[model samples]
Target: MTNMALSGHTFPSATLTCPNCQTTITYYDVSGSSYYGCPNCHAFFKYENEGPPEILTTFQPSTATPVLPIGSEGYLNGQFVRVVGLLHKKEAGSFYRWLEYMLLRQDGRYSQLAEYNGHWMVIEPTDHTYSHYHVGGKTYTINTDEGQYWLYNQYKPELLNAVGEFDWNCLEDEKLTISEYIRPPSMLISEQGATDSKWYKARYISRSELATAFGIAKDVLPAPSGVGAIEPADPDDRSGTLLAFTGMLLVAVFVLQVILSIVKPSTQLLKESYQTESDSSGTIKPIITSSFDVDGPTVLAFNLSASLDNQWIELPVTLINEQSGRVYEFSKTLEYYYGVEGGESWSEGSRDDDAVLSRIPSGRYHVNIYPARDLGKPVSFSIGITQNTMLGSNIALLLLLFSIYPISLFVNKQWHESQRWSNSDYSKVYTEEDKS
Candidate 1:
């Protein structure tokens, strides 16, 4: 069956495949470029007998195929590519899990993967190459040529090979250097060499082998000069420092919020309160007063009537904080107070008084009261807000939250994305920046 998992605007089967094994071949698309491999024989190929391929479509298994075995070279992801790579950590955990992936691109750019938690989990590569291989009964894949090289070279057996120096049960057995055990010859260069004018060099060896060939150990490999200050390579120290700094920052923010909340000024109980005046004669009108310096409206009330025979005839309600503006549903409230008498103080309970102005901001206000029996004489009363209870506490809490998480994520994401590391000496196939 055709692989439904395969996807791209340019299909792989539509590109090139090995005639012998029929496995799809991938390549770097360009004039006069070529690659080598045979899936059936499980053999590596070379471009020795054939000159650089001149076109993507014209290079067939017969014309481009040599005894050295490069069958077909197809393009991937709009760039000419045939390989993939990744960096893995050997972690010690419950049942063993490889938790991270660091991928390299054609331009030596690096990208990391979605984190993982598992044992013997073989994840296939994404984009370009179908390089999933079996390692310890699980499938592993390299998505790019550089990734392929990095794994097959730096840590060869871990990525795609099930037998890494030893079988699963015999993991502790000694293994010999790959070059000492494997032969070095290409089919393209026969006993009777091909008459083709061009021949490709065979440098297909593990990176460690290549290092051995070049007499350069990894330790001896010079760090590229002038990139930046080179710190002594102690991995644990860097991580510890970062975590400590983050914890300290969080503690500091929490302490500051507590201090700010404590320092917020307390409001004094309403002073210059509860003064009243009653009018002369059989009816009564009481005017009450209070002092405040709030920025919004305040209200004060007085009892004038309870029964229909002595109900409030009318009342003057004015919002007098000139600096503040408002529109009120005073009619709804007036209907409740009208024609009602002195049974409960019109300002009888504090809950009733607070309810009237709970939603209002700090300010000054006045209301006039007249007994229903005496509709002509409504007496005015002054009201003022003592304090704004919501503003200060809410503001401090908001600042504390912003200091911790969402704000931190925004800053950290930008910092990570902006970070660009150079790997020019490390790889050639992955030439693009690791935008992942």
Candidate 2:
């Protein structure tokens, strides 16, 4: 293969007559030596060292028309380029077929535009050589051999059709070995053959972007199917951000709760004793406590202590606002029992119970207590009321409610990750035991 700089040329186009079909063809050779295929006869020819053209084999004409046709001019990578040639190639052992458009700048620089299943990628030859690459801070090994197990497969792509002019002798059924390393939606491709080894950096291109670059309509391009090797990672995925936000909200709520518990001093409103006799019927006389002023949103807790032997006591209490007649009702139950079972003494229930009312408004309030006793037993109980008491259950419920958003975001992120890795050769669900 001849490598010549095609820049600084002063030729329009070279006219040649094909020796086989006698078809007259006009071709451009900015690279000093180039290949040309007859548009009508589809005969391949090569010219080297600016000499006369030599006839190669004739290939079949392609039925497929490219979105960017040969001889079409466009601006790519800040340079005006013309689509000079097109090669439709397919994998040797697979049904995978792709199109490669050869782009030639006026200054003789060459690049390739590849399309596979409506996915577009632009590959430019790079002067940099490397056995490994650091992409996004992660190191990836490069595979050079044609046959071995690797992260990516080695392909011997056979040329199916050719049109227009190419720098190299583009022939049909000619197979070239290529090795690729991919970090989607970017890839590094190494072309190795009898000629010099070539490296290229490939980046994914969206249909819209390709259309705009080539001055074509977006609908004219085919829609992409499966995920492409160089398809970009979605930047709009904000799962990590949402999880962080939820985590911070949880921490803030916990810190606020702790600060409120330490800073706000609870005020004892009422502490009184009430008794219910065994003969008491229906409803006992309500014990009214002295009125206390509640100045802010506060928690009103009532602690009831009772003495009962193997019996239960129920108390219904109401806190009534004197100014607005607003009423808050709560219930507490007390029971204690002791017995010997299996030669072990055990006690069940407790002699004390408590109830809490949260976020009560500011006002003057008094308590009314009604007591009920079981089995005609007398019960003596004391009631204690305090404001601004912390409710642990309420805090726990709030935390649980706030966690729903993060949990949902996490599940969605996991699903997206699974989709991204579905094409990988290595999977998380596979294990050595399962393989065995």
Candidate 3:
């Protein structure tokens, strides 16, 4: 290939007349381009170093137009480039087809724009290489210097139609073997032939990017459908930020909970003992406690303790606000049963229980206690009330609430990844065992 530096409004050119179609064809790179495919009749011609060009073969003219037409100039990948060539390729054994647009810069560098199923990739030649190994009917490649890239596809592609110019005889009989390796938005491709080989690095590109860079209308670019091989799993740029935000929120809630627990310890409001005698008619009047003052909105803990000998008691309590006449009702059953069975001492229940009430406003409150116990025993229990008790469950609930977006982002990423590898031979989500 020639390395002549071109400037603004300067373009290399050569003109020739096609023998098959008698149509005049123009060449953009004089020293580099030796093959010309007639755009009108779809006939390919090869030009030697010092002779008249020879006819290679011909293909039926296609009705579909290239997205980036030949000779289109644009700023791409930080370079002013011209679309010098376009080749329509088909898989050797399949009906699948794609387009490859050759781009030439002023610095004599070449880049390729590959389009498949409306997805675009910017590919550039590279000097990197990798070693490959085959196992279980799959091919894998390892690049010791640049890390691992999984093999995606290996196939032979035939040139179905060609237009504009190329550096080599693209229609030559020597077959080419192409392999693709992918690592999500990045790809490494190897093109091996009988006498030469080439390596290319490709990164995914969006339709809007190309349209903006080339000053083309966005509607001219096809809309993408299924996930591309090298397409990013998550399109949202804020996924990482969201994940970090969730993690920081969890930490902040935990730290705040700990600080509040230390600085604002629980304050006992009331602690009193009540005695009840067993009554078969259940006519015992309830004991009412004195009014306790609650300063502001807070959480209240009601604690109960009792001494029993193989007996149980059900304590039903009602808290009434003196100012508003509002009532809160709850119940707890305290039991302590012990026995010697099989020469082992065993206990089944505890004699203490507690209940929590939240969001109580500033007011004076009193408790009405209703006690129900075993018919043959009398029970004595002490009741205690504490205010401003820090609850860990609140922090847990906050963490769960804050995790919704991050978890949904993760699920969306996995779903996109699964879609990307759905048609791949070496799928990461589905193994051979799963298929069986």
lDDT of 3 at 214: 83
Question: Could you tell which candidate, 2 or 3, scores higher by TM-score?
Answer: 3
lDDT of each candidate versus the true structure: 0.29, 0.73, 0.81
* Predicted candidate 3 versus true structure: per-residue lDDT over 1-436, tens digit per residue: 2223443442665577777777877666777778889998888888758577788888877655688888788887788888888988888888778898988876787898999989899999988766666544354754645566778877898888899888888875228888898886889998888988888899998888889878999899888979998888765566888877877887887788778778766799999998885347776658899899986688999999988889998899999999999998999999999999999999999999989999989899999998888865678899999998877677667877887777888898888888887767674433466445
Greater TM-score among 1 and 3 belongs to 3
How high a TM-score does candidate 2 get?
0.67
Model 3 off-target regions past 4 Å?
1-10, 133-139, 144-146, 172-174, 270-280, 303-315, 331-355, 372-384, 429-436
lDDT of 2 by residue, 1-436 (tens): 2233322222245555665677665455544537776667777787667577787777788766688876677777787777777888888878788999988766677888999888899999988664743222122355444322123445788777776787776652354677777655567787776766778888888888788888899999989887666565454446667767778888898898789878887788888887884335555556677888886688988888998899998888898999999999988888899999999999999999888888889999888877777766578889888888778787788877977766776676566456645655433333455344
TM-score of each: 0.24, 0.67, 0.83
